[model samples]
Target chain A: MSEEIIIAGFGGQGVLSMGKILAYSGIMQDQEVSWMPSYGPEMRGGTANVTVILSDERISSPYLKVYDTAIILNQQSMDKFENTVKPDGILLYDPNGITHHPTRKDIKIYQIEGAKLAAEMDNKKIFNMIVLGAFLKIKPIVKLENVIKGLKKSLSERYHHLIPLNKEAIDTGMKHLKKFNIEKHIIHN
Target chain B: MAELKLMKGNEALAEAAIRAGVDAYFGYPITPQSEVIEYLMAERPEKRTGMVVLQAESEVAAINMVYGAASTGKKVMTSSSSPGISLKQEGISYMAGAELPAVIVNVVRGGPGLGTIQPSQADYFQSVKGGGHGDYKLYVLAPASVQEMSDFVADAFDIAFKYRTPVLILSDGLIGQMMEKVVLRDQVERITDEDLIKTHGSWATTGKTNRNRNIVTSLDLQSEKMEARVHRLQKKYKQMELEDLRYEKIDCDDAEYLIVAYGSSARISQKAVEIARKKGIKVGLLRPLTLFPFPKKQLFELADQVKGILSVELNSGQMVEDVQLSVEHKVPVEHFGRTGGIIHTPEEVLDALEQKIITHGHFRNHKTRESSIL
Candidate 1:
């Protein structure tokens, strides 16, 4: 199966690195993967996004107009990418800073208090890892072992000591997500 | 040998150059390609292999430094994006005229002027058709994948030294910035000074101890003498055309239509071919790996079998002219592209194939075809 995903947020929210770790996990599993970032001047403080494709076969274009899943970290990313998810696809978001919730009936929507949980854990850097954990909890396209290995491969040696904390954040995120039923929301609307 | 590692295209090229025993790297920083020099500097090839890495004041200075080092028979290289590459044209022409072996990488961006820093194949004419101010050809290699970006560095140097001409790795920002897994080769040793003297001793200006004085210049005042030199260069180019033509044909055995592209466009068109096939349309892709030697013969032969050809690029219409020239009106050739940093999607390419080449039967109207070719 091929999974195309987009993760978007502010510049320092680890959106790009989360995608990189996902791609590396795909590689560890001997799958074909590609990671492309929206680079350049916009990466300073503006919204930054990365497209990650994991496939059993060769991947074609690194850029995509639509994605099977979108992991949005903030309201701006949620506003931009909510509609880009394909029908029956997944839209996972951290609802901490989102003003408007997703209202699509054809796809699955899930929310995680990633930023709030990371703050409670006293480390804001694990926000992306928590969100990533929620994505895997819903999809499970890649094994958790592979993700740990990917983290080892992606992070430099000096950052190795933080892997356990990151792993704990991912587990917490996996348990903390609340599924949002779009059908119920649509009927209420 | 290094194990498989995920790397960006620019970093892969830099690592491959070090493993290929590049004697020196002289370049200026440019977006989408700065990692090439940055990686080299961080790795400190000077400490590891005694290789020289210098950041020049400008692209012109960097290319001229390459020219000087290549003249001494050392394996040297430089890289830049489109605008920076434009500044190195004069030096490139001088290198080509002097028949010096060097490698230049162009991580192309949107063009015409200082356009957007997005990936583009707009430099097709500049690279394959000879960008410099003279009648010289560069051995242009277009790499579609990060693996090719790494492997082609060594291959380009081999071809460059064999032909005694500059070779260009024509890539773009997409390949430069994206990350993929690459298997790096074992490190090779740089050629010793004695080996250089033994191989290029005749023409290289390495003290000229026993033989007559060696001179390297593109300037020959006499018209007839210059004409003779041009004829010799033409002969070399002819030889290259005969020996170095490289291309890849995908799913063409039963294809009724063909899409021609290179570099990043080729990757996208390959996907288009798959999508078209799934839709019951027989489409194929012809990707030119070596743009200079340009798989013209193969394209001509394919033209005899396919009903039509579509030249897809990321430019207004550059390589389309070459595609048209190759087919020689045997079948209708049309161009479809998105310029100014916009890359065409696979669905768009498939739509163009159906709209322009197949379903509409646009080739059936001879008058329309003639006008379109013009």
Candidate 2:
């Protein structure tokens, strides 16, 4: 199946890194993947987004329409990508950032207190990991072991201590997001 | 051989040039390509790699330095972006006219002016067709990967020295920024001080003990001599076409639609081709590794096989014209791109390809759509 996703937020929110991790994992799994970012002034601030597509076959273009999934880290990102989500797509959003609920009833929207969960684990920066955990639970593209391996590779040498906390945050997010999987009736017509 | 390190394409090019025994680097910093200069500067290759690095005041001065160094028969090089490359074109032409061997890299960016610092293949015509006054060609290498950037540096220098011409590494920001592992060369052959070309001995100066030596200027007072010079350069270019047109074809043997792209845009097109393949579409990619000595023959052969050709680039229909010229109207040539700072995604390319099939039967009008910022 063609799984096209866009992870968007401001700079330093780990949006690009999250997308990179996903694309890199897909590559490791022998899945065809493409990752295109808003590699412009948006990288400096305003807004940042990366579109990732992982398919069983080669990816045609890095551009997207009716993206199968989206992870919005901030309210601005949610507003930007909300309209583009496919009817059967899953949107994992940061509850702290997105105050307003998604208007679309066709798509499944999961709200998680990512920052709070990560902060409880003593590293707020792992909010992306928390959201990533939610993504792993929903998408099931790469196994958790591969994601952890990719995460370890992505971490800086100095920040090596944070991996355990990040993993904990992922587990927390996975546990929380697992409740949504039961409703097979929620599938789009 | 060790495992490949995830290094940016521009950095890899710098390391490759050093390993290739490039004697000196004279360049100005421009985004996408600035990392190359930074890599050289940080490494301070003088003691280790035996090369001199200089950050020039302007691209004009940098190209002039390259011209000076190359005349000495040294493997000198320089790099810049589109606007900066435009400034260096005059010197590039001069190097070509003097038959000096050197390498110039143009890490292309969107522009007519100071366009935003991003990946662009708009300089295809600028690099292939002479950007400066006078008829000349710089053996241009368009690398699609950081690995190829390393692979092509030595080849670029070899071609330059072989033809007594300037060679260009025509890259874009995507390749410049993206990291990939590269297998580096072990031995580096550096030019010694003994090998320095003392232009003081040659007629590089007018009054230097010459008993009235004829000027070796591209400007020939006699029309016949000028024609001969042009013919000579043309012959060299012809030889290059026979020997140096490097390209990669993937799944193109039975492609219904062929996507012609190069450099970073070609990498994105590779992703797009994969997606199209999964959909049961017989799509293929023709990635040009050498921009100049344009791969006309391979493109023509593909035109004979494919239903139609789609030229994907990061510019406003620049390479499309070249593809048209190559195919010679044997088949319809369409283009898809996003200019300025925007990068065309694989999905957009797929849409264009699908549109090409669904809309017009075969003969398609050239549609140049302005890319919107997302």
Per-candidate local distance difference test: 0.90, 0.78
lDDT of 1 by residue, A153-181 (tens): 99998999999998998899898887876
Candidate 2: list runs displaced more than 4 Å. Answer: A1-5, A19-35, A52-69, A83-89, A103-108, A137-189, B180-226, B275-281, B354-358, B362-374
What part of the reference interface contacts, as a 0 to 1 fraction, does candidate 2 reproduce? 0.33
CAPRI-style grade of the A/B interface in model 1: medium
TM-score for each model: 0.96, 0.82
Q: What is the lDDT of residue B141 in candidate 1?
A: 95
Query: Residue A111 in candidate 2 has what lDDT?
Result: 63
Model 1, B344-366: lDDT tens per residue?
A: 88888888888888866553547
Tell me the alpha-carbon RMSD of every candidate.
2.2, 6.3
Scored against the native two-chain complex, candidate 1 gets a DockQ of 0.68
